[model samples]
Target: MSYQRRLHPNLHMETDSQIKQPSGRWGQRTAYTKAPNITDILAELKLGHRVTPVFAHRSYTWELQKMLRARPRPVFDLCYLDGGHSWDVSALGVFLADRLIRPGGLLVLDDLDWSIATSPAFQEGPETLGQFSSDEQQAKPVRLLWEEVLPDLGYSHFAIHPNLGWAIARKRDTKAVVPAD
Candidate 1:
């Protein structure tokens, strides 16, 4: 008998990981962005056979939802959501991750208070609220998800690890029923 573990569709990928180098000339400026592209990261990390890497460059509904529809359920033990900063996008990720994560699985969210307008961490954006005032920046999506959404979704409240700017939650156990004679 042989057992082979398959990479989830989200992590499986095939790509040409060659990024063109820049000449750094006046006409040919630097050909690099602040963040490395998905293919670049995959090649750098050497995650070829371990998992599938789905670059969700579009709306969650369009990308994640379509993927979920094709793949089997309860496939993931942990999901880290840190890409999108808006409430709606984060909420969508959480909802979808809920279906993908197995029972007793863990879900982690990043950027407890990470809006460009509200966060003091970024100096370039306009400050809607006072910087480092109430720490309301921490409350936007992080608190709303941890304090409100998780409990409603049958996930136990885990500590929001502030140092790493993440909130963790675990799927709760199902209620047991006693047999009646």
Candidate 2:
């Protein structure tokens, strides 16, 4: 996170190249203060040893490809796609997860069966869908994708039951099997 320069030809995420894993409790604070910001804290404590955290603030579009192309590293073992509850965004997340998640990795999907099917008459109240626009009203349930679509794409719901419409899917493992002579 140190500094994210939008989507570019490269990830453009370099923190003075000063990445290290300092053992201790990492706190959130400014750079000059005693506490370290989430960016530096994660860089040092989480991935400083041998990994990199590629964060994107914008939508998951073609920029994902550019980010992958720029960094040469092992596939991630876990990925949580928390974009909007629309089919387009969910589909895009699945597509990206397929490429970024390593075989046998876990891909958690949020907001399953969350259509919130209420008539427009009931779509009032500031606490409800009144805050969103027309497009947001079309936010459909994602369980259909997880149940009907993702299976065909080489992913399956984990053994654990999906909690509150949150599906835990694992990528199909493609491990190599050694044949005995």
Q: Give the best candidate by TM-score.
A: 1
Count of clashing residue pairs in every prediction: 7, 0
- What are the lDDT figures for the candidates, one per model? 0.58, 0.57
How does candidate 1 fare on TM-score? 0.59
lDDT of 1 at 133: 45
> Cα deviation of 119 in candidate 2 (Å)?
12
Model 1 gets an lDDT of 0.58
- The residue-by-residue lDDT of candidate 2 on 67-159, one tens digit each, is 567568447888766544566766876787678889889887765655534433334432555555665566564776787877898887784
After superposing candidate 1, which stretches have Cα over 4 Å from the reference? 1-48, 120-139, 175-181
Worst lDDT 10-window in candidate 1: 12-21
CA displacement after TM-score superposition, residue 34 of candidate 1 (Å) = 6.6
lDDT of 1 by residue, 112-139 (tens): 6565455443443334334434544444
Top candidate (lDDT): 1
- For candidate 1, the C-alpha RMSD (Å) to the true structure equals 10.0
Tell me each candidate's TM-score. 0.59, 0.54
Q: After superposing candidate 2, which stretches have Cα over 4 Å from the reference?
A: 1-55, 116-139, 159-164, 176-181
